[model samples]
Target: MTSAISVDDVHFAYDDEPVLRGVSLSVEQGAFLGVLGPNGSGKTTLVRIMLGLERPDAGRVELFGQPAETFTDGTRLGYVSQHSTDADATMPVTVREVVTMGRYAHAGIDRLNDADHAAVDDALERVDITDIAGRRLSTLSGGQRQRAYIARALASEADLLALDEPTVGIDADSLARFYDLLGELNDEGITIVLVEHDIGVVTEHASTIACLDGELYAHCETSAFLESDALERAFSSVRVANAHRPVGGD
Candidate 1:
């Protein structure tokens, strides 16, 4: 299968602290790959390297069979960034308008044409936000806004979908829905690259699992990788206990 996103011996550093050290991985076409790691483990840095937003100190990063620098921007790769730009108060632009912005990479500030409008409408429907398509983005609940961001990526129609902590701020129900939709997209030939903190939920759907701790610590298929030493090392501090303590009783 063709690889949508590939990195070979990628090394990155900020000052003296090394972020990525010989990090090598690949997201196969139509596969869902998850990046699991701690806060300072270089998850975002890897995403930036893939997007060509940050230059890697060493090694190579390739996207769609070409060098990362070949593509000027993320037209071929769609991204759902970590933070939602605006959430408080209210904004004037409707949900549809926000989604239409995804096509900006291709349209470049032009008015939405027939194809763009259809893409926006379809994206809203895919994320199950069609009912609120006309409503202002800021008026929606936390989950709704998260769905809107996913819709934006859907509208972009990129081959590779990279999400960084997309489930943040979303409720349980919406998070489930988001993952389900991503699976559907992956089945339809969209390669998904996810950097998520939550392990249980991500591993459940991702076909391949990758763990990073300031480098490409672990990269392998899901079942094998999850059981390997890399998984334990990447989540060394991550603990999810079955036994719960009451408000004050442990």
Candidate 2:
């Protein structure tokens, strides 16, 4: 299989506070990779780097065989950040309008033609949000709002979808349905990089697992990851470190 994302000895920091220390991994095409880590563990930072939203201080990153920094096909990549829905809470946009924004890159200055409209329609249907396509985004529940976002990605025909804690604040049923949608998308050959804190959910759905704590503890098949001591080693270190930190230390 082709590699969708490649990271090698990547290093990054927020000023003097080191976040990622020589992290390395590769995500193959058509694979669902679940990134597991505790809070402040660089999971979001690493995913941002992978999606070219942030630059690494050292080492390299490649997306779809090209350098991530130089990869310019915006339509091929989709990202839903941790606070994506929070920003949409007050937007006076309709679900269909939000999904149609994905086609803007392809349409450029030209108005969307028949093909573009079809794509938007298809995306809405695929995500099962066609029924709510005309509803105001703010009026929908968390899960419905998330599905709308995913529809937007699908409308863009994204090859790689990277979501960071997308299920945050969502109900349990919605969470399950959201993962089910992801599974269907992955089966249809879209590469997925999901940065989520729910280890049980990740282990249940993702084909592979990448455990991290400033550095990568393991990157392997989910089954293999479960058999190893990676989670114990990674989370135990977090507990130990937190125990020693001052109440208000940065």
Candidate 3:
């Protein structure tokens, strides 16, 4: 299978503090990859680098075989950040309007044509948000809002979707439904890179796991990762580091 993302010995930091050190991994096409780590382990930062939102300090990253920085096809990539669930109540945008934004890249300066509208409709249907397409985004529940976001990605025909802690404040039933939607998307060949704190859920859903703690401890099949000590090793390192931190150190 082709590689959807390739990270080669990437290093990054904020100011003088190091976040990632020689981290490397590859996500194959149609694969569901779960990025796991303890708090402050650079999981979100790593995903940002993968999506070209942030550049690596000392290594390279490629998306769909092109250097991430040079990959100009904006329609092929979709991202849902941790804060995506919190829709501002003041914004008057409706669900359909939000999803329609995804086609802006393809539509350019011209108005959305028939094909674009069809894509938007298909996406809304795929995520089962067609019923609420006209509802105000702020009026929807967390799960409904999330589904709207996913439909936006689908509308753009994104091949790679990167979500960072997307289910943060979602209820249990909603979270389950969200994961089910992700499973269906992955089955349809969208490469997924998920940064999630829920280890049990990730283990059950992701095809592969990349365990990290300022470095790549393990990158392997989810089953193999479960059988190894990578999780314990990574989390233990975080605990050890925390034990020696100065008072009030961030």
Candidate 4:
């Protein structure tokens, strides 16, 4: 099968400090590839290279069969950043208007055609946010706002979705719900690259795990990675002796 993303001998540096050292990875289509690392571990840099936002000093980055930036004209690339906050909800923007902006990346300066309109509607529906399509974006709850962003990503009509720390501050319910969407999207053959700090939770949901600590330690099946000690070393911080669970458990 054709790979969704390929990073061959990729190395980058921010000033004199080296971030990535000869990083090479290939994410298969329909595969959910997770990138786990600590702060300043080149996780964000690597993604930036993939998105054509930053240039790598050496090696090549490819999407599909061609260079990442040259993959296609105006294809969708969903990105949900880590620092997103719901505190800005009262900005006086409607959900439809916000989601519609996702199409701007693909639409020409002239006007949106029929297909673009259809894509916008389908994207909102894909995330099951059609009911609130007409509602104000600032009025939605935290979970709903996050889902709205997910819809925004979908509106990109992207063949590939790359997210950075998507579940950082979300509640347990919202986290679970968002994860369900990731699984559903992956099931539909949408390629996903999840750059996350916590691997314990997402490993079970991903098809492959790329354990990164400055370099790729292992890229293998989730079951194998979890069963071994590598996972612990890669994701040591996420483990809590007593996790905060909901009261009166089922």
- Strongest candidate by TM-score: 2
As a TM-score, model 1 comes out at 0.87
Report the C-alpha lDDT of model 4 over 30-149, residue by residue, as the tens digit.
889888766666788888888767778898998776897676655557787776555445577767777787788887686878887898899788777899988887777766676777
Compared with the true structure, the alpha-carbon lDDT of candidate 4 equals 0.77
TM-score of each prediction:
0.87, 0.92, 0.91, 0.82
The superposed Cα distance between candidate 1 and the true structure at residue 229, in angstroms, equals 2.0
Off by over 4 Å in 2: 85-87, 238-240, 243-250
Candidate order by TM-score, decreasing, is 2, 3, 1, 4
Model 2 clashing-pair count: 0
Per-residue lDDT tens digits for candidate 2, residues 1-250, read 6599999999998987889999999999999999998778899999999988899999899999999999999989988777765558787999999999989988999999999999999999987889999999999887788778878988998999998888876777677778988999899999999988889999999999999999999999999999999998988885548856789757
Which pairs of residues have clashing backbones in candidate 4? 76-158, 89-138
Better of 2 and 4 by TM-score: 2
Better of 1 and 4 by lDDT: 1
Model 2 pairs whose backbones collide: none
Model 1, span 123-209: residue lDDT tens: 998988899988887787867887888899999998889999988888886777788888999998898999888888778899998
Better-scoring candidate (lDDT), 3 or 4: 3
| Candidate 1 worst ten-residue window by lDDT | 237-246
- Candidate 4 wrong stretches, greater than 4 Å: 85-92, 131-142, 233-250
**Backbone clashes under 3 angstroms, per model:** 0, 0, 0, 2
